[model samples]
Each structure stands twice: as C-alpha cells, then as structure tokens.
Target chain A: MEREIRIDPVTRVEGHGKITLHLDKKGDVRDARFHVTELRGFEEFCVGRTVWEMPALTARICGICPVSHILASARAGDAILAVRVPDAAHLLRRLMNLGQLVQSHALSFFYLSAPDLFLGWASDPAKRNVLGLAEARGDLTRKGIRLRAFGQETIERLGGKRIHPAWAVPGGVSRPLGRADRDWIASQVPEALDTIRTTLRLFKETFSTAEECTVLGDFPSLYVGLVTDDGAWEHYGGVLRVVDAKGKPLVDGLDPARYEDVIGEAAEPWSYLKFPFYRPLGYPKGMYRVGPLGRLNVCDRFGTPEADAELEEFRARGSGRSGRVFDYHYARLIEILASLEQMKTVLEDERLLTPRVRAEAGINAEVGVGVHEAPRGTLIHHYWVDPNGVVTAANLIVSTGHNNLAMNRSILEIARRTIKDGAFDEGILNRIEGGIRAFDPCLSCSVHALGRLPLEVEVVGPEGAVVQTLVRD
Target chain B: MDLVIGIGNLLRRDDGIGPRVAEALRVSPSVSACAVCELVPELVLRLRDARRVLFVDADARGTDVRLGRVRDEGSRWGHTLGPEGLLELAARAFGSAPDAWVLSVPGFDFGYGEGLSDRAEGFVPQAVERASRWLSEGQVSADGA
Candidate 1:
C-alpha cells in the first residue's frame, strides 16, 4: 500500500494552500505538491482603468506589502511616459521600499518564523503561534511586537498610514518628506538598531545548532534577483539577473516588461499558483527561486558596513560558502540590517525633502512595465494602456510566482528526507512547514483573498492507505 | 464601551459599505458617542481590547439575506476575528471572550470592476442605520448578549 500525506491551508504566511505527499509500495516518496486555492485575477481586472490610477489601485493586491505594488506600478507607468523621475521622488520611493523590507521581514522572522525556532520544532501546534510563544517566553514576543511596530511606524510616518499608502504616484510621489517625518524616522534609528542587533543575536543562536545547518543545507536551485552592473544587490533600481546554482550569472539586462520573453507560467492542476520557469530552460529544467534565499545566493554583496560584516560571517558559516539554505534565514536578518542602514543613508540625503517631487508627464505611449524588489522578492507590473490612458491589458508576475518552482522542489526534498521517520510524525510535518516558510510567500498578493490560518496534514501507507492526519483548526 | 469597526473594501462596489457606514458614524450625531475604528487584520490585537466589537464588512452570507439588507448577525463571530490558528489558540489560552457581531453587506459583484454595484451602494444608508442602532443600544453582556 502506498502512503499519502496532506497539509491543508498552511498558516502564518498569506492566502490558502495545501500540501499532499504520495508514497510508493517501498514506502519511498513518489510525489508532492503545494496547492494554492485562491485565484489571482488582479491583472485581468486592471483592464479599462486609466494608467494614472495604477499605483493606488495595484496597491490593493495585498494589505501586507502594498508599498511594493505602489512603487513597482509607478515605475512601470514612468517607463511608459519616458520621463525621468526627480531625484527627491526616487529617494522618497526608496525610503518607503526600505521601510517595507524592514517591517515585512520583521513580521515574518519575529512573529511567524520564531515560534518554531524558539519553542522547538516539535512544540504543541496549538502553542506554536505568536501568543503561544508569548506564553512560553513573554519578553521575546513583546520585543517582536515592538520591533514590528517600528516597521509599521516607518510606513505610517512616510506614507501617511501603514497598510496601504496612496502617496507614490506616476512620475514621482504625491508629496515630499517633511522635517517632522525625517526626525521621526531618525529618532527611531537607535532603537531599531537595538532591535536589529538583538534579532541578529537571537537568529544566530537559534540557527547555530548543527541540526539546523545540515537539515536543509545548501539545496541547489537557480537564483534570480535585481543586481547592478557592479554585481551589488540593488533593491530599488537595477536589471533583473538569473544565475545558475554554480554562482554564474546566466542572463543580464532582462527587461521587467519583457518578462514574458524570459519566463513562462505553467498551471498545476492541483494548485492555483502558477509555476514560473525560465523560458529558455523549459519547466522542469527552468526551476528557480526568488526571495530571501535566492536573493542571498544571487547578490555579491549587500553594500553596508554592518551588513557587509554580517555577510562575511554568513559566507563563512555556510561551510565556507554563502549559498546554503541556512544562509537564507541568517541573511534575511542581515538584509533587515542592510535595509535599516540603507534607510538611514537615503533619509540623510537632503534631496529627499526637496519640494520638487512628482514629474508630471502626459501619457505618450500605451505600454509600460515596472519592476522592483518587494520584501519577499522581485515584482514586475506590466500594463498596456489605450489612447485614452485606460488600461487595455495587465499582467503581473509577482515575486511568489517566481518561487513556485523552488517551493515545489523544497516540498519534495523535505518530504523525501522525513518520510523514513513516519510521514505522520508531528515533528517531521512541522519541519517541512518550516522549510516552506523560509520562502515566506505572499500568496494573498498573488491571488486576492484573506482570513484564517488553516493547516492540514495527512499520511497514507502504500496503495494509498491512510495512516495518520493532523489539522490546525 | 461599545465598538464599531467598518470592514469594507473601498474599491470594490458594495464592499465599500463598511467604510462608508464607519465614516457616517464618525460624523453623525447619533452614534458618534461610542468608540469606533476602521482596520484590517494586522490590528487584531489592538481590537481584542474592546469590550464589544461590531464588525461591518461586505459578506456573501448565503442567499437568504438581501443585498444591502441589514440583518442582526447570529453567533458566528469566532471565524472572522483572526487566523484559525491564532483564534483557536487565543481562545484556549486566555479563557476570555468578548462580545462581537458581524454586519455583512450583501455583495453581488466582488469582481475586479470599479466600486460596488449600484444596488449595494443604494442600500448603504439602511446598513448604516442598523449598525448605528446596534452600537447605540446593544448591551455588552458577559455572554456577549
């Protein structure tokens, strides 16, 4: 009898999804999948809207990372008009993007990922949440909340409100930063640094265990992210590059608008999430990863003093290389530090407070593409406008879409490694979930829906015989 | 103290009902005396403090309720509060319960099109009136009665 295992509506990230595993007669893993239930049709509905409204409208995709959509859409619209945005406008946009990275990553690392790290992977499922972690270690949870609040405050201070800010507009921002905003951000830097250092220490401690290092060590997959010609990671502005597992850049200057040419989307019958593959390599060979792990593998350096030091440590820790999956989690904290450092740099640039912000341009063309590094990964927004500036076509290749292949690969690897110990074992299931969470996918941004952290797990024997099941109701 | 939260999406047509109602209460003399707020889930903890929470959002609560019709919600408040895991864990951990109600706006087209359908928008005032009455008159009983 072949065994089967399933996890439904995995929680703490975004959107709805289920995972299923199939075992052959030999009790060996034969197949696995991550199925996304929600349908993302933001692109389909964007049609007929004026290009000018893209920034504000696209931000509605996800309540968590709307700033990413706002910036990416505005950049794409700027491309259509063929106008250079003012320096202040660009700086303000970068500040907000950095703020997003800090806040979003904090939410993922402290609130979502820490439960498993702190309480142990096999901790009670019911007590494996923020509140549960609070019960176990109140001080840590409080710090996590305070740290997350700082990130949200950054959004509120600059964008005027945290969740969705309509400040970023085409050609530039609607307004420039005021002194009050700068002072507010500056005042928080010390505490933010404290939180960053504390988090770094905590992460280092949590992940230093030999088991963690070897559990998911250096799994190979193609990496993709935005990089400058100098080979530095450029979150706000740069060309998209795809690199193979061997650390060689495979392609450069990949236009955000021409994503269709470089990548392709394939639908899995079991999942609403589309698997995006490198067009040149085809689906199976084209598997690649985006987000923290992929970004760490692709970028040569972070370009900040403290972040540089941390990156060196990360490179040294990954068995003398910087490309391991362990580095992905560790590097996320470093990137959090990098983002804060970058925020300070961009904020201090006096040009950010200048009066000249929005660079108004009459829409001279109908087609445009915008791409930017969202907190989770790279995001591309492409739109085709009509003569009246109304959208005729919209195609969004979100960051999560890019990681579909990598996620599938990860699920299989985890399932295979843990299947020998009994597929239904709680510890194994939790670890598998932990590995997937390393990707930190924003499914809500991809397919629009919200509410509920539902998780389901099932195990079956050979010939599809049921063995065990667990669900977080 | 009583609380009213508007939970509608401003872009999608009828989904705007909650925000509109919250906005009306914020300004209206009738229900302005009570505590009120507009938020999404990230602020769930901030809301857990409320003695009573009346949530207003667009909902497709089966076919019985007419679009925009304001109906007294039943005891299904547990589902909408937080993610299932958090909600379940909080309920088990705290052993404390709060009074709550959900005001569902009968939604016809929640598609990507602009604003709520005319039918939904036209019924906004009635929804507001009902929500306002609940805020003003409902008691925050121990059982959330």
Candidate 2:
C-alpha cells in the first residue's frame, strides 16, 4: 500500500508551507515535496512606479527585514543614477544593515528555534513556544527580548521607524546622523555584545554537539555570499564570491550587476518560489546554499577582532569547512557579534556625522542592479527604467529564493531518514520541521500573502483515504 | 501617555484598517499613535512606558467592530506576535505591563491592494470614536455598544 504523510503550514516559520512524504508498501519513505502555498506578486505590481519610490515600496515586502529591501533598492537606484554615494552615507547604510542583521538573526535563533532546543521536541505542541520557554528559563527569555530590542532601537533611531524606514535613498541616505542619535546608539553597543556572547555560550552548551546536528541537513554543497575586495566578510556592497564544498574558491570578485551571466532561475509548477542555480553547473546539479551557513562558508575572515576569534573556533568545528546546515545557528550568533562590533566601529568614526550624505543625480542608465547580504542571505534588486525615470520592469532575487533548491533537498533528506514504516510519529515530524527551521526560511518574504493561516498536516492511505491529521492553529 | 498602535499591512485591502485608523487619530494630542506593518515582540518595549496601550487592527474572523481587553495567551515561536504575546513580554521584561486592549474592526476582502473595502472603511469612524472615548473615559462598551 502506498501512503502519503503531509505536514501543512510548517510551524514557527514566517510563511505558509507543507511537506508531503510518500511511502511504499514496505513503509519506507520514497520521496518528499515541500510546497509554498502563498503568493503576493510583488514583482508584477512594482511595474510602472517611479524609480525613486522603489526603496520605500520594496521595503514593505516583509516587516521582519524591510531594511534589507530598502537598502538593496536604494543601491539599485544608485546604479541607475551611476553616482557614487558619500563615505558618510555608506557608513550610515552599513549601520542600518547591521542593525537589521542583529534583530533578524536574534529573532530566528532565540524566538523561533530556541523553544525546540530548550523544550524536548516531543513537548506539548501548545507548550513548545516562547512563552513556555519563558516559564522554564526566564533569564534566557529576557536576554532574547532585550537583545532583539537593541537592534530594533538602532533601526528606529536611524530609519525613524522599526518596521519600514525609507531613510536610504538613491546615491545616499536621506538625512545625516545627528549627534544625539549617534551617542544613544553608541551607548547600546556594549550590552548588545554581552547578550550575544551569553547566547552563544548557551547554544554551545546545549545543541552544538547534539545528534540532530549531524543528521539535519548536514551535507556538502556550494556556498555563495558577498565579500569585500580585501576578502573580508561583507553584507552591504561587495563583489560576489563562490566556494566549493571543500572550501576552495570557485569564483571571486564578480560584479553584482552582471549576476545574470552566472546565475539562472528555474521554475517548478509545484512551488511558487523559483530555484536559482549556478549557470555553469546547470539545474539540480548547480543547487547551492545561501544565508548564514553559506555566508560563513564563503568568507575568508570576519574583519573584527572578537568575531574573528569566534569564526576560527567555528571553523575548527567542521575541520575548516562549516557546511552543515546545523551550523547556521552558530554562524548567526557569530554574525550578530560581528554586526555589533561593526556597529561600534562605525559609530566611533567621526566621518559618519558629515552633512553631505546624498549625491544629487538624474538617471544615467536604463538598467540597474543592487545586491546586499540580507539577514536571511544574499538579496538582489534589479530594475529597468524608462527615459523619464519610471520603472518599466523589476526583478527581485530575494535571499529565500536563492535557498529554495537547498531547502527542498534538505526537507527530502530529513524525511527519508526520520520516517519508517509509515508511523509518522510526533518526534519524527518535529525533526522534519527542524530541518526547515535550520534555514529559518521566511515564507512571508519568499511568497507574498495576507493574513495568518493555520498549518494542517494529513496522512493518506493507498486509496487516498485520510489516515491521520495534525493541525497547528 | 496612552499608546495606540495600528497594526497591519496597508498593501492588503481591509488589513490596512489599523494603519488607517492610526492615521485618522494622529492629530489627537492625548494619544501617542503609531502605524506599524505588523505586531512584533519589540512592540512590548515600545509600549512599556505607556499608561495604557490600545492595539487597533482588522479582524477577518469578526463581523462587527469590537473592543476587548488584551490578555496573555502565551507566545508562538513565529515572527508575528499577537496582542497577548506582546502583553506577556511586557509583563515579564519590564516588570509591569500597561493596561492593553484590542480595537478590532471587522474586515473582508483582504487581497493585495492599497485601499480598504467599503465595509471596513465605514467602520473606521466608529473605531476611532471608540478609541477616543476609551482614552477620555478610561472605559469602552463591549461590541461597540
């Protein structure tokens, strides 16, 4: 008898999705499919707008990481104008991006994934959440909340709002940083650093050597991220870098605007997200990973002292190559540390307070491309404008889209290893969801949709009869 | 200060009601009103200093404009935190949470668009009025009575 198990609306992630597991008569899992059910059509609606509005409009795509879109879109607009931004403007933008990374990565690790790590996976579905973790470990919960607030506060200070601040403009930022704002931001840095260090220590004590790390999405794949010309870890603006599974450089310093020459997007009817592949390797074979794991894998070293030390320790974990998806949590913590360090460095520099932030210019080119390493991974915003500076077309290669292929592959691999004889146990289901959580994919950012829907999982027998169902309301 | 946060994405039809209500109430000197795209945990910190907090949002499950007290209903691990989660975090992190309420306006047609449905738009005045009354009188009748 052929049986199918489905976990719909995978819980604790940003978007809506489901997993379907296929089993043969022998009760062995044969195949699996991860489906993204929501769609927003951001690309279609963005057409016909003025190029100046791209930064503000695209920022609304996701409330969690709107700053990422705002910065990337602004950079794209800069390309269209062919104007170099002022140094002070660049530092301001980098500060905003680092704030985003801190908040976003904290949300992913502490709020979303920590419950499963603290409470046993088989804990009551209702009790396996942040509130529950708060009851079990109040100190840790408080640290998570405060740490995230530090990031949000930094964003609110610079962008003027925590969710969507259109502060970044074409060729530069809209306003320069005031002394009061700089002082307040500087004061918050030390505590943020302490919080990240504590969280890293806790994580190392808890799950760094757990069995799940070896089993969940632990496989070799190509890694990609942004890197400075000097081979330092970068997030805001830099050339492309690709590395093989064994930490060998495949490509480096490729111009971001010419991404089409090296990358390809493949469409699948079953999912709304597109599979981005390395053009040289072709479709499934070219499947690579992005985000924290990918970013850490591609960078030579973090440019900061503390983050560099942590990176060295992190590298020692995987014998100089941290390719396991499980390491994403650790990488995210290290990045948080690095972001705080970078934030301090930028704030301490007096040049960031210069009055000349934006460059005045009209559109000098027909097409422009902007790229940034968002909290989730690498994000690209490409726009085509008419002579009057109205947008004719737009293509957004979001960070989540870049990891679509790897996510699907990870889901299948985990399902096959965990499920047997069609039992579909709660522990097994949790492990499968953990694989997806490792990437912390944002379905809301990846797929466009409105409202929060309940996640439902169902099992069907050979005759297509409902066998069992799990629903998270 | 009394804080009122309007929560929802303006791009989604009736979901924009919260932000629209906030925009309408921006001139009120007594209320510290802000329009946010969604409810996140950080909101608790922002609202911690307020004497009272009122969250105005669109409710697809509701049929009429309703005002109710916010309570701690536990927290989910996802990014979107509800009114209950916000209150809980405030209580735990700040030692005491402000009195909180939810002003839910019935909404339909939550598709991708910039404007609100006629039904949701019609309830805006009533929602704003109720919020004003709550601010002045320190109490609101249930179910818009």
lDDT of 1 at A114: 80
* Model 2 Cα lDDT, one tens digit per residue, A1-473: 79778888798888788887889998888887778877876777788998899999998788788999999999999999999899999999999999999999989988888888888777887767777777777778888888898998899899888888989999899998899999999998898899999988888877666365666667778888999997789998888998899878888999988888878887665566777898899998888888898888899999999999999988887787865777888889999999999999999999999999999899899999999999999999999999878998888888988888888788788887777777778878987888788888877677532222345676879977889987655
- lDDT (Cα, tens digit) per residue for candidate 1, span A1-473: 77667776676677777777878887778888878877767877788888889899999888889999999999988987878899999998998888888888888887787888789878887667666676676656655666677778788888888877998888999887889989889888778877888879877876776667656434677888887777777888887888888768888777656677778876654565667888899987798887776777677888889888887787667644344554556767888888888888988899988999988888877788898899889898888987777899877878988888777777788778878734458877777777667778888787531212244566868956558876654
| Alpha carbon deviation, residue A392, candidate 1 (Å) | 2.8
Question: What TM-score against the true fold does each predicted structure earn?
Answer: 0.79, 0.88
Residue pairs whose backbone atoms clash in candidate 2: A40-A448
Cα lDDT of candidate 1 equals 0.73
Residue runs of model 2 more than 4 Å from their true location after superposition = A447-473, B8-33, B46-51, B57-68, B71-80, B92-96, B103-133, B136-145
lDDT of each: 0.73, 0.84
lDDT of 2 at A278: 88
Kindly give the stretch of ten consecutive residues in candidate 2 chain A with the minimal lDDT sum. Answer: A447-456
User: Fnat of each prediction?
Assistant: 0.04, 0.31
